[model samples]
Target: MIPAMPKPLTSLLTLLLIAMAPAEKLRSETTTDWPSFRGPGARGVAEGSTIPTTWNADPESETNDGMLWETKVPGLGHSSPVVVGDRIFLLTAVPDEGETELNIAAGGNIDAAKDSGAYKWMVLCYDADTGKELWRQTAHHGEPKATRHSKATHANTSVCVDGDRVVACFGSEGLYCYDLDGKLIWERDLGVIDVSKYDIGWGYASSPAIHDGKVAVIGDDPDHPFVTVLQLTDGEEVWRSDRSEVCERSWGSPLIHEVDGVTQMIVNGFPWIVSYDFATGEELWRLEGGGDNPIPTPFVSHGWIYITNAHGGKAPIYVVRPDARGTIKLDSEEDSDSLVWSVERGGSYMSTPVVSGDYLYLGNSNGVVRCFHAKTGEKVFQKRLGKDAGVIASLLAVNGNVICASENGTVYVLKTGPEFEVLAENPMGEPCFATPAVADGVLFIRTTKRLVAISEPE
Candidate 1:
């Protein structure tokens, strides 16, 4: 015999049910959800009709007219913000005290003003409409093992959101999963992380990509050079593939593409752009020519895979034809036949190449952006963006405009064409490393100190 519930209580229960209903329904819609590092297929291309090409072009205004909303963030990070419908997610970290010990371990000179106590891993949730912080999750409020020279606080990785579950990887700390409302689901520890190879550099920065039902993570540990795929529902290890030729870990994100009805997971790490069968985690094909430290994600177009080795000692773009069998090497002149063409000048070190129609565009860390023909790998146009601006974030194409953010928190919006056209330059006044996310007419930019929303004025 249960007692009758009050009317207000019943109404509240009904409201709660309505709120939870959307989370379940969102699983059915694919295009609106950016579930991985660079959106669907990891292509960094968003599909929607409302992306803006020109907004607030005049820089003389006292306030940003077309800006939607802006909110300040805690700490700094190079990881980009991920969007899933109305909620935007970002990862950040705050370093701990004992400046000398942590700095020494990180292989850097101690700076009293820059040192902050015990690193705190944070995941923040903001309203995509108003740029308001709805909730935050902080993990492991302690000092990290060490830091990387060019690494940021939130350099662990970007967030991947699938329906109600959002996954974020904080190396050394663990991998975390949260519900859409910011409730902790589960966290898995990957063990102690050390940067012995890159001279005790920063932790992992590869964002996870989800395909079919597994989340793919490239764990390039020296003892275990493998890609780990986990079940999306329960975070269980599905399959792990290990191969010979141990390569160093890179900051590049993995990409998923379909070629001739076969789905392949393409990962560009140091020394290789290895493709794996999405379902079984089997190494299908490998294109080896990257530098000793590959950090940019590979872009595919015109039946060719374009990859650049940032510090490969040589500045050359490796264009490989993926129509071959296992492990194609471009070491010799004969082997270079499979290679379409290699451009040795004006390549990128950090920024991933963006393919717009038939042209491939890339910005190097030295602020030089170049465009190349997609079919023949021929250089089309090149221009220097900022005099001293170094780009650590990938370029974003929205409504015919190429939006690129720099490490100094300035976003240069240029028109994509055979020639460079500077449209607008917006500054957030803080360091930024994450690529911009454009969806449903709104542009999302995450800086070290804030998350800004730029859109057409109402």
Candidate 2:
């Protein structure tokens, strides 16, 4: 039996105004197409789209209500799909036709996957409207230089698009640039980026960011951790900053934004969070103390930059002003001159938080979701989505609903408000580790086996 449709939020007009006003002013509006990770500016909020509240995505089901189409993507990948215009692009690593597996569950196992002999790092493009394979290019083919976690993948980073060019970073493999038609323009070898934890190989997952014709990538390895910016046109090195002194290791991506005529890139890390000038790679501001194993990317919303991380008994949320300078080490939750407000706890470990209306939504790997006041550090409400359900993908806010996908293959649509209310719970019928992407009116979900597109029935 099909589930009933979820009720829409009551404050639609207020949310539309509040979410779109600051988004438009900052030039990070989540429009019809999602360009990068968590959409533009990593806000994870989409507008002018209709996302289905319920769906049966199981291919063999007799009646597939909200399922538009599903296609089998080769091999394993945790990279989320990125949509630009009518094209969708992603990356995957295919072993040499051997038995490979990904443990899609909630556990405390800190072991690496068995070494697959050789892998083909591939770049695939598809027609967004029909889920048709437009083209596929082999970026590289060889044995992996670094090991991956049992729950992770070799293709862990999502691809970013700028105009007609798309960039993919395969960690230790290399960074490849390609045209929209599967033509390789250039590639760069950034050395061996072995992202580990406590001397254990856990793999790399930091994605790339594009802004003002420059591509930025962060490699937080045990040794020689750095942030490098290259020209998007020809892959020319603009500047690279050494981050070894500030952070030991990080898996979070870089966030680029323009504030008061200054372009700055912010990165989330443990023990310290830093911001650098985008043009010259000079240090602009730094914040001391955060979660240990940082994974969530920093994003801007409500005229302030929001950064969060978890692990090592410290889960903090820091809201900083865009025009901040120098170093800041928080001693309390009070509002500093540069940092608007901070909280010592209540941050997600893997899932990135999303802001909509006057509330900010966050979820941890345990499927415990919380809502907080966006401007001030006040807790609104906390509720568990489901027992035994785990969330690794980030949250998505669209059409007045917060989309939370669990590793147990369920997507919960919660209404946006201060009170706790779950409008709908839809199952994807497959494990999901990557975040969902929305474009035009279709919702793209990269499950463990296939890429499923959901939309309202005609």
Candidate 3:
């Protein structure tokens, strides 16, 4: 008989086993649960699922080919819907005294919305298959600690799930955790997480990321920016690292990835893009220079980490190695060991690019879509989807097709390849700021006023 292993040794071995596995393999193979923003590992790819390419967005249309069901979602929110098994979870903020509207456009407007009142920060769940309301909970209710951009919403961060627990971050309001049955387990106060630009409040949009029984959060407040890790089981603080000096403000979500036997939480910022040790919150690597307004989350793909930002006259796409350390120089030549390949321009301002098959697809806010070689920084093609359609939602990959949703409510589906081929252009009628989620062969999209589930109708 073999001897029993010690608890500490067993835990260490368990971690090693997890670290050895690829980030994609960490998720269950039986069910594709889009538990966070841009899906598992933030890769934005749903394998073995058939996402609908065409659908009728009209509510009263009888010939709805791919329309499954759309349920009315109350209030305004930019938080994308998350999926866990058979339920869909999301966050919204409904004002108690006044109503606010979203300014959906691609122009250069830095004004704050003229709206403020006591809001009910709500957590809502719905049946994934039927689009029926499951339950809703008010996480917090009061006036916001800060204002939001004209194009931003009070609830801009997406919720994340870890099979058993659901977590939502309401910027300065609070962070709350709940069970699958809508039972409140715990909540944490993160103080005033004011994410601003030039002393103007743009509100916070970074979503909480969960990995291996822990949750990672990025609070890029201008005064006290930080990256913190908390226990997902009970919301206890595990570690926190300050970034007041390096980072000014950021709206992107933190990414948790394990590469080269080390797990790191990567964040995007204006002057510095930093990576921290996931377990201890220690600063591991840093890169300088990118778009001034860092709104795109960093993702790992094809054995390289991809980081992109576009604003303030500098649009760059940086592809770095997983084991990079210290401060990497911005002038490093392409194809280098540490810096990999980087381009000075052609990065998206709002949408996060997605890599599928052989090309990486990027969509800008002004309806421009570009495709580049995944391995080499070679531009394949660049085309405009529409005249003024704003593509704010990040790109999505299903099987071999890329889904691009514009601010004008049109969902463009294109076949993945070096050639530019649009498969379909379906309209959603209302504006769409939140990114869509996919799970169990269904597409769940959050428009301005509803959560619509789309699938190929039989």
Candidate 4:
């Protein structure tokens, strides 16, 4: 005889058991999409994938080599590549060498910015499988309206994708959108944005974060700073909130997270780590005593937010707990009701760190890699990368391997745990300033001139 169907309440209980299983057991056993600056949601963690422990991209033959494919892109931009399905999208700023370049050495730890007399901002597409150029769309072309720091470029901000629409923001130049086939949909000229640190001319570099059919941008210009959300379908303004608590430079991109059934937009600023309500652009919560020139992206993990910045001043790493409401502040050296824990001294100068398993790994400007317990703020290990590697690109985690690339072109893979173990040090033979993107066991790394894909031998 056939067994009788389970009752409604019994079926509901069975479904709950499966839903409450460990994440590893219930994770979507599929290759996820790397659709934004630091992959999906900018969490910097790739689920269910194993990247190559060692690989090279200089091979000439197309046979199963370390280099799957390499494509040389025109112009200069530190924007990271985004991958969706079979295509990869990227942005560039072709320098018109005939014109004057705005090359300036304004400060420390950054290369002087150079300007070509005239420039062309472009949106290019490539085949993710073979690195073949699919299409190139020029978004804007003319003399730059704003200046750039020596270490920054015209196209420093990465483009973001939402289904079929791709949005690209060329600070001061304009904000443009295009369909998947390179058709221009809508454009908005937001005027010249004076994004500087202490009135120093550093180019803007914050990428837009797309969520729920809206694009959210955090512009921390010293004059008339504001955070606004726009509708993706028609470029209509949804909401704009003026920021009154910023005084220094912040090139970090904001992040969108759904916490406790409410969507919050979290941004890292000079003196405040602020969270805003996404629906109405209302200030939900704020944290004080942040870095001076914050460039690291605000990292949201589990239910906490981790941020760090250093400008020779209040260089701190703050671990924040959720359930924050209204105004909040924490002492520079003490933990409080909203702060889970904070490190008053040690933090990264640039490059957003990544969390793997139970430990958080950070790589700094001097290539010093450190590990800390994510929950209790316990120190695990601190080891210099040796050779003065000096890491500017952020770190990422792939299947328990913490991937960190240095400025001088070495990708260090470390095992994730309390004890440190050097998994592999893969050198790319070029200066890497942009972060790498991981999808389906492949690593797409952008050096100064080319975007190369690395994967296991086919």
Candidate 5:
């Protein structure tokens, strides 16, 4: 028989045990997970109020004053770095220098570079705290038969990650899904890409978007012109939407947003800004007049959808509403009830626009950054960011500054206001086409040769 315990002793023990139990972490909207192309919910707005208005005093010192960690990445890709909890993921291609076998089955050509061998697709994972490489997943290695512009790379598309898996699409090579530990789960070959028209442009750059338990991709190949949805678990084809005309291939990623209370995936491709019901791949509305090769991802806000086409002959910013779904005519100048407004002047051809406080900001390929009134389509301000052109990366707003990264490796930080005030110009010393990702007060920047992490000194 055990001796009876004292009431006071037992009660104290219970209280101590309860207090020792681990507390559940609170979910934060301000401290967000930069999950997709822009950020959580596909909205570019970051939650915190203490965003750095001025660049940290010292960028090079490792002092905890602001910068957390900065590290060098393996290869080159225009794809931006995606951040999850403690890990940041980036996709790149390692160019082989000599005698590489050609994987012609993937699509297109197999020309071996006499000097540089073949380009191999690689996905990199880095530690957010220390900037250490966690693991590297090499998807494929072979001589790319197809040729892309000198500015493009094999791994130009950004990678998307969910809970335990990371997904990346290497055009012509295939779509690959890997576990957090670098284990290959599944792969789907989209076949070799035909780039004969655009001078054999680089494979494909449209990043995949996950919505409603499905991974959706717009595989607008000339041969198989369709927008397909696949099961996120096993990579099985769920449904494919067929279009009458073979849509021209573009590097723009599809945007998923709710318009007038209905969830829609708005895509700006060759000929139109087509809206599809997110539940089913059914075309809901189409706005035909746009630029020739629409590459920038479309953004939506305040019930109106904004879209732009870059070098496309008739570049225009189309304001569309889903209310006029089936009744509006495409070429009517009588103000189709669906199209609220269309502005052709001062629109971006390559970079996507950033919306903030009733204003929209955009940077063209020529390094000119402009702001427009979101509702009235009024031009607010336009200024040149860098002396040379090529502002392909999208604009990002965090804290109170509007950030734009140039291809030449300069990041211009300006206050988000009516007048353009250059706060600070930060350089990574390498060329970059990837956008910046801000998390936990640190900024993740991917240049052609390395991935750098900057933060305010503690």
Candidate 6:
């Protein structure tokens, strides 16, 4: 080694190196972890992927198109699979009599399971590569204190994984935190959250979103509606903002978007589409018009935030700028002062719309798929999916195709563009309601019976 530099020269070099460094290093998200509800930022866009056009659940096949492994999950829940490095995490509720079938369209009017038994709220882990299960941890074991919607399970909320702990919210049951090795870290009980607007019991289904080392969850029940954030490292309340008493129940999940230089958490709710400071729970802006029950999560893309909900008195798609403030209530769809564009009609119901480049894809509750210009809201094409296939899960745009799945477990792959083309209709042969998670060249699909990992052969 050469002799050390002069003290003044060394100091100058150190300063130069420090200045060259980025002020804040952005996280390079890899295919290893699916940290949240819709996978990374809930964008529903898998990066650099060539997803299979056709897949089969049957392992024994003469052809090479299906699931790599089909591992039967024990319980019934609609929570999507959250994948981490080498492992996939999901939650389920195992009732005593094994209630398997549910019709989400029934809302809260359907009859509950006859003589329902104590439920088992479980946290399960599986090997990502092969569908081999890794571990199962019991988050809660008791009779469900609060009755869920007839079409819902006790574990409608999905589990979220931070770097250190995986969080699972069982609505009225409790919120649980577990280490990667199935050890209990912490748990919080937020009481019975009966999220019914019309005095009908539609259980809570909002998954927790983790941002800036804090997990934000919404309790949009008619009884107690509030937005609460907890420390990710340790289960401590960072902030809790009480929502308006007039706000009806909302099933949409909270999402955290880092726009420009500011970070804001956007929440979808009735009577208001609210944005809050990610660090503190201070309200940033509130838009006052949405459906009576907001089920679609807010989406952020292309430097614009999109919020929309249908099946209410007002159905409007508000594309707002990141630099918004106070009240953003628009009088009509022609309000260009605050909104970039507003689609007054043809919004999503249960499915959260996804943006693939310049096009916006909407999959309705009745298996109807439509595409429109994202900025102009001009209709491109509207088509129904496979026979008797009604879509409930949100559509995903992956590898130049839109993946639209129906409750009948058929995934319709459509070519993305102004022209309408049905690419393929792959059958899962099981009941499905959750959106499939795509990462690491594998599609993790959760059905009513099992968690299947599908990938093309080498």
Q: TM-score winner between 4 and 6, please give it.
A: 6
Q: What is the TM-score of each candidate against the true structure?
A: 0.84, 0.92, 0.92, 0.89, 0.85, 0.89
> What lDDT would each prediction earn against the true structure?
0.70, 0.88, 0.88, 0.80, 0.71, 0.79
Of 4 and 5, which scores higher on lDDT?
4
Q: CA lDDT of 62 in candidate 3? A: 62
Ranking by lDDT: 3, 2, 4, 6, 5, 1
Higher TM-score: candidate 3 or 6? Answer: 3
> TM-score order of candidates, best first?
3, 2, 6, 4, 5, 1
lDDT by residue (244-359, candidate 4, tens digit) is 65434578898888877899998888677788899998888887755677899988876798888877577788887767776665653333767888888678877898889989
Q: Superposing all C-alpha atoms, what RMSD in Å does each candidate have to the true structure? A: 7.8, 9.1, 7.1, 6.0, 6.5, 5.8
Model 5 TM-score on a 0 to 1 scale: 0.85
What tens digits encode model 2's per-residue C-alpha lDDT throughout 1-458? Answer: 97754455546766677777864343334346688989877889887678788888866667778988889999999899999877889899999868568876738888898876999999999888789999999998999999999989999899999878999999899999999898999999999999898677789899999999999999999788899999999999999999889988889899999978999999998767999999999999999866889999999998899999998888888899998888876764442778888888999898999997888999888889988899888999878889657889999989988898779888888999888888987777788888999987899999888898999988
Worst 10 residues of 1 by lDDT: 99-108
Which regions in candidate 5 have their CA more than 4 angstroms from the true location?
Answer: 1-31, 53-66, 98-116, 244-246, 259-261, 322-324, 327-336
Where does model 6 exceed 4 Å of error? 1-32, 58-64, 98-100, 104-115, 332-335
Candidate 6 lDDT, 1-458, residue by residue in tens: 89989999999999998777654321223454567787887888886876688877643445537668788988788888988777888889887665556764453354553325687889988888888888998788888776666666766777888776899998888888899888998899888887774566667799998877888888888777888999877779998888865367788899788876778988888778889888888888888755766898898877788887877656667788878877875775434566777767777877888888799998877778878899887888888886667777887888888888777767788888998888887777776788888878888888877888888877
lDDT of 5 by residue, 34-95 (tens): 87777665556565734454443233434433445567766667778788877888888777
Q: State candidate 6's TM-score.
A: 0.89
Residue 76 in candidate 6, Cα distance off native in Å: 0.4
Over 4 Å off, model 1: 1-31, 48-61, 96-117, 154-156, 195-198, 222-224, 331-341
Give the CA lDDT, 0 to 100, for residue 20 in model 4.
Answer: 87
